[model samples]
Target: MGSRTILSSGTKTEQVFGYSRAVRAGDFIFVSGTTAMGPDGPVGEADIVAQSAECLRRIEEALAHFGAGLNTVVRTRVFVTDIDQWRRVGEAHSARFAEILPTTTIVGISALFDPRLLVEIEADAVLTTG
Candidate 1:
């Protein structure tokens, strides 16, 4: 087995919650449920599209830490408070992953950790070597 690397987004909540924002084990990287929630408050507020975009941006940042990117991503799971807004969320997601075309699933949930947050995204990626 390859060595595991724990990656952080430098969020106080991560330490308090005792979880890494992302972790790499062997060639695979797993990104936890990422939100637009900031230290002060939510980034995109009640806008699903904005929140979705913000989530992808953070996920990309996390993937970059592992020398990977959206291209390396194989799958994604998106949780949203409103299933009706899936189209808006998909538009935001596709904007980042159009050519990469990673397998994705969007599920509607009752609520996130915060009521202001409209969306949360998780990703899995595998590093490609030459």
Candidate 2:
């Protein structure tokens, strides 16, 4: 067993929901489902690719906080409101993890917490160096 740490994104939803954005236990890091919510509101507006990119970016930020990166990711889960828009969302996701190609799952849901959010992503990573 190694050190454990909690990482927060400082979003109201996190506090309201009583969950951290990510948790690091030993050499593994688990990131919560992330969306593209911005200062004004959900990002991407109506573009699934952009929204997906934002979600990945948020996940990367959380990983970086704990000295990890996308390369360390072992798995990812993506949830989308529309299955038909998978191509665009997959393109955005591929741009980030193309080289690493971590195990990934994409699913379609009826809705998200916010209607404006079309996609949410969660990731799990293991530190390889240690």
Candidate 3:
């Protein structure tokens, strides 16, 4: 089957590292690990909660480009630099996916590509065939 690339003017995607921000194969949209980095710059320099929200927000935007939304997400993976912020991160995540509640996994990580990054999230979604 053929695949499609999803991109938006609101964001800058990275592919030089041998990966895409998101790829659409048929009706499935696979999103790569999204950090809190925005078009302007990274968010929540020291706040994990805000960072987590930003990551999810970026993922939502990527999904939306492909006619998909957070509600269409079937799976999500979260990586955090600190485990102590799990509660706060979970709250932020729940607020975003409260209605859909996609299967999710959270892990405590030592660090990320950027030391300022407190959280990263990746998602998999199924777009409506309409």
Best-to-worst order by TM-score is 2, 1, 3
Error of 3 at 103 (Å): 0.4
Instruction: Write the residue-wise lDDT of candidate 3 on 1-43 in tens digits.
Output: 4677765343334543656778888788998898887545578
Give the alpha carbon lDDT tens digit for every residue of 12-57 in model 1.
7887999999999999999999999877778887889999999999
Clashes of each: 0, 0, 0
lDDT by residue (tens digit), candidate 2, 85-123: 988899999999999999999999999987989999999
The positional error of residue 47 in candidate 1, measured at the CA in angstroms, is: 0.9
Q: Extract clashing residue pairs from model 1.
A: none
Best by TM-score: 2
Residue 34 miss distance in model 1 (angstroms)? 0.3
Structural similarity to truth (TM-score) of each candidate: 0.93, 0.95, 0.86
Q: Which portions of model 3 show Cα errors greater than 4 Å? A: 6-13, 38-41, 128-130
lDDT of 3: 0.83
* Model 2 lDDT, residue 85, Cα: 92
List all candidate RMSDs to the true structure: 1.6, 1.3, 2.8
Lowest summed lDDT across 10 adjacent residues in model 3 is found at 7-16
* Top-down lDDT ranking: 2, 1, 3
Candidate with the greatest lDDT versus the true structure: 2
Model 1 / residue 109 / CA error / Å: 0.4
